[model samples]
Target: MIALLLALGSSLAYGCADFLGGLGARKAHVLRTVLVAAPASLAVELLLWPVLGASFSPSAAGWGVASGAASAAAFALLYQTLAIGPMNVLSPVAALVSAVLPVTVGLLQGEHLGTAGLLGLPLALVAVVLVSAGHGAGGARPSRTALLLAFGAGAAIALQLVFLHQTPPGSGVAPLIVGRAVSSAVTLTAAALLRRRLGPEKPVYAVSAAAGVLDSVANLLFLLAVRSGDLTVVAVITALYPAGTVLLARGVLAERIHRGQVVGLGTAAVAVSLLALT
Candidate 1:
């Protein structure tokens, strides 16, 4: 139950962060938005160290670096794919693949789920797809390159989660701190390389910073949840994050919620309830 709650919180935080990051990216280049957000994320993780405590064991450091590198790639690929996208199709594809890969890894590692969990898991995946489905039509179909990028982004995201889960149990938040630090460095390097392409238009700094803070919180929660819970369960629940994003769009941006999303929200609630009861 505790793990379920933590995963839910992580999902909410991630959804909010993505919403803000998307807003910031709209105002400036994706790299420029991340240039602000990545450092801010690292700062938040640093602040958490004193409170949560950390031990940078070699295993933790190695896994942290791996996750961090994967995270940077995921961020770049995901944003670029979305920019070129028919977002509705690509978003769900990425989300589903991210969840599926982690779940597969967990199962291969011999984690088992109960009947309720088995049922709820597929429903949660369906909800992920439905919630991310956009209402509009008539956009250009996604190219083969966009599809490949989306798949790569999803794989990167899954690797990040799996690597974090592989950290030593006693490492606490040390892996997260290390991961954030490495990701920040990578983001800065990418920004530097792309400086010529990144126009002079400034990103919304406040929005980007807020997104970073939330993203850090989300990662922290996910790490904690994975440590305490079955990765298969936690990953699927976290993948339901798009529901929160859709809700925020409705409430904040006054965007229309589609029928698919409404059903998805309901399905997500039911899925969570089933998982909790188990």
Candidate 2:
């Protein structure tokens, strides 16, 4: 029960961080966001290093780097998708892919679901879809490229989850650090390729940095949760992050929530309850 609660809290914190980081990326350069955010995240992880009491392992480090790179791409593509596509189209697709991929992998590895887990799956899927539904007001409908990128982001996010799940407990923070390092490299390369300067935008950087810290902490907690419990349940609960992101957007950006989102949120709560029962 405690592990489940920690996983849920991590999910919400991650969602909030990602939401703010997404906004920061929109207001500033993507590369700049990564550059500033990665270090901030690293700092937080390092601060918590003592409590982690992790022992270093080369394999775990490798997994972290891989996880980091995938996540960076996921973030970049997701941000690009949201910048141009309708929220209804991109957000849910990406979120669903992220949730499904890890759960699928866990299932393939012989992770059997209890009855409650089975009930949670469809509800979780619905929640992702609803949370992603945009207010039917202003905004251009999704473009072909934007749609493609959204799915692409989903794939990358899925890869991130799988890689994180691969890391064993007590492998140290090296995995997380490696992931950040790889992500930093990937984002920096993307920035350079786009001929965009890494700007000194303090306000945007500050927001991104704070988000990075939360994100890093969430990653650590999630890894711990997965190590301590069933991967399927942990992944499902953590992937409910879209709920947090949607709630934050509705509150801060005055983004109108469609009825779908409301339904999604309600369904997600039920799914969480089911997972808790397990």
Candidate 3:
């Protein structure tokens, strides 16, 4: 239950981070947004590193870097998709895919939970899809390109999560440091390859930087959760991040809430209770 709460908290933080990152993307190039977010996360992690007094193994750090590489691609694509609009379509695709992969892997590995957690799992997944559903104006058919990018981002996100849990126990925040460093490098190279300029509206810097901090923190929470809880539960719970993101937009931007999302929200609430009963 403690791990589950941590994962849910991570989801909220990640939702806020994605919202801020999307806001930044609107004012800057996608790669520029990534460059800003990654390093800010790295800097914050570094400050926490010494406090943790953690040491690392080459193998663990390697896994961290591998996770970072995949997440860099995931984040870049996610930002690009957000910048293009119609998050209604792409967000669900990414969210569901990210959750499903880990759940499937856990099931295959013979992982199980209390009966309540089991019952809640599929409901949680269903809620994730509904929560991401957009209505009316944003509900227009997504372009083929957007669908493709979202698919890639989801896959990368799943791979990143898989590798993240592989880091040795008791490594503290070491994996986070390595992952952030690797992701920063990957994002910079990708930016250069695409010829995306770092120079953008100065105001975007603060937003992107804040996004980085939130995102990095979320990653730490996720790793902690994975270390303490079942991967299937953690992944599925965290994947509900879109719920917070959408709620934020509704409150801040006054975006219309889809009926499906309202249902999803209620369903998610029930599912959490069920999981907790375990």
Top candidate by TM-score = 1
Evaluate model 1: give its TM-score.
Answer: 0.96
lDDT of 1 by residue, 81-142 (tens): 88888888898889989999999999999998888988888899898888887864446578
Candidate maximizing lDDT: 1
TM-scores of the models, in the given order?
0.96, 0.90, 0.91
Question: Cα deviation of 22 in candidate 3 (Å)?
Answer: 1.2
Candidate models: Cα lDDT each: 0.90, 0.80, 0.84
On the 0 to 100 scale, the lDDT of residue 195 in model 2 is 56
lDDT (10s digit) by residue, model 2, range 1-278: 77688788878988888788878878777667767888898788777778776555887888888898899888878878777767667787888878888888888899887898789877877787777666642465677887789889988988987898898676867688778878877777776787545565543867888898989878887887887877777777787887888889889998777787788889988988887777
- Total clashes, candidate 1? 0
lDDT of 3 at 25: 73
Per-candidate count of clashing residue pairs (backbone under 3 Å): 0, 1, 0
Model 1 weakest lDDT span, ten residues long: 132-141
Comparing 2 and 3 on TM-score, the stronger one = 3
Instruction: For residue 137, give model 1's deviation from the true position in Å.
Output: 4.2
